[model samples]
Target: MERLKKLMVGLILLCLFISCSQKNNKSDGKLKVVTTTTMLTDLVKTIGGDKVVVTGLMGEGIDPHLYRASAGDVDKLSKADVIIYGGLHLEGKMAEIFEKLPELGKQVLNVGESLDKSKIHFIQENTPDPHVWFNTDLWETEAKAVTKKLSEMDVKNSGYYNQNYEKYKKELERLGEYITNRIKEIPKNSRVLVTAHDAFGYYGEKFGLEVKAIQGVSTDSETGTKNILELANFIVQRNIKAIFVESSVPKKSIEALQEAVKSKGSEVKIGGELYSDSLGDKEHNTDTYIKMVKANTDVIVDALK
Candidate 1:
């Protein structure tokens, strides 16, 4: 009878251990998520909160247009439960690899791909400008798409994701209104936003500012002498006071424009650097998307107001 009792106790303990292991596996063994850019990682964190482990392939200040994923990156992505990328060909060399990853049964989400087809303007063959984050209104839509995808993948935490997403979406909407109101402070004629590249078309379009670029839509586009001359002439003719440089692009382009204007007896200052391709350093005010827009707003307001 004593031996039987001991055996029964051991069986009960084993069953309890198995049940505990199963419960833990169901709750928090870590749901691995991989994002193509730091921007997406920020959005994912806003939705996933601490329930998911998120990693960004591109670091802060890194331009997504020229990024080449390493072998280690491939291995990391291969292990993810979901792979989220900006798509719209923003990944450049990694585009094909991302498209094919879904074959491995990973949930590959192209957040920008969910945009309304009519609202998209293609910058290249089968590629829409991946800089959709410029328009806070548009970005709120994308954030909702991200929340839906993440919730679908990890339904156990759906409520948490939905709540966080709602909060973030409200913040994004407030940011949009803030920009619209602050930009109104600048004289209507002074609303010209000139930058190294044409990244701000959406921002300008959304906020009622005139956007000009020394380079084409992509920073990868080489600035031609004709383009520089024309931009300088426009600045001189319009009496545009400030030309902005982007943090990720070379300042030489903007400097050249400044010199061109100066040679023609017109003065145009470099309106503080804007966070164009990527957000500013992790410690800076432009670290988060909201902070980034505010930093850019402050610079634009001070320069153009």
Candidate 2:
């Protein structure tokens, strides 16, 4: 009986020790960083290396424009050691909430906000374009800014951040080259990108394509029959091969245009859904900015070619 009691006591102590060790391991893991978009989260993951645990608040195909911060999201934000957002009012309704995060003493990094004011094209003079990721070269600058913020947050991991940032920058440069080469495959005059909205302006500017949309920059912009008719007419007149539907926005607008074009005896194919305002599934390659751009390029090439 005495031996059995001793064995039980040893087992209990072992279990307690294991439990405490797991708790400490979790505590020592890394600083929790939450980003508004998958692109930002991926970049943070690269720069932060093993020193940060990054998560995207927006999930696959989730529209940042229409996104509302849920109670669970708030709880996530509250627990984060640092939060990163694409800024430039990309979050739309959630903008005010993010603006208040710094007031709560949480380190908030608005990486796009560091862009040169002169380079940014705004919906209004005060509101900058949030689609910086579309311009891969420009995104490098944003990544550097993010790297700086990560270093500031965890100075001990500064060396790792710097090393990783350099590696990430090279990858971005490679992606830019690949996009340039792929876009070149499209006939010069056929290089027109028409979508539900003006989300691809940066993309067009970067890749030498003419871009047009029925709605303006914001998905919240109202569309009317006249706008639909106008876009259909333009598509038919230009003989553009494809029009893309955004993953976040409704397809009704694009469908209306397609029907209008068909009535005019011109058939413009609907290009596969594009990841404009959000990333692809986390398990997929397009879940990050680099992969998102590559996915878009592939779809665009397939449709246009």
Best by lDDT: 1
lDDT measured at residue 136 in model 1 versus the true structure, 0 to 100: 89
Top of the candidates by TM-score: 1
Query: TM-score of predicted model 2?
Result: 0.88
TM-score of decoy 1: 0.89
Evaluate residue 282 in candidate 2 and report its C-alpha lDDT on the 0 to 100 scale. 56
Q: Which digits, one per residue and each the tens of the lDDT, describe model 1 over residues 129-240? A: 7778889878888898988998888788889989998999889989998999999999999999999988888898899999999887667778898899999999999999
lDDT for every model? Answer: 0.82, 0.81
Taking the tens digit of each residue's C-alpha lDDT, what string does model 2 give over 231-267? Answer: 8888888899999998888898889889999999999
| Residues forming the 10-long window of minimal summed lDDT in candidate 2 | 16-25
lDDT of 1: 0.82
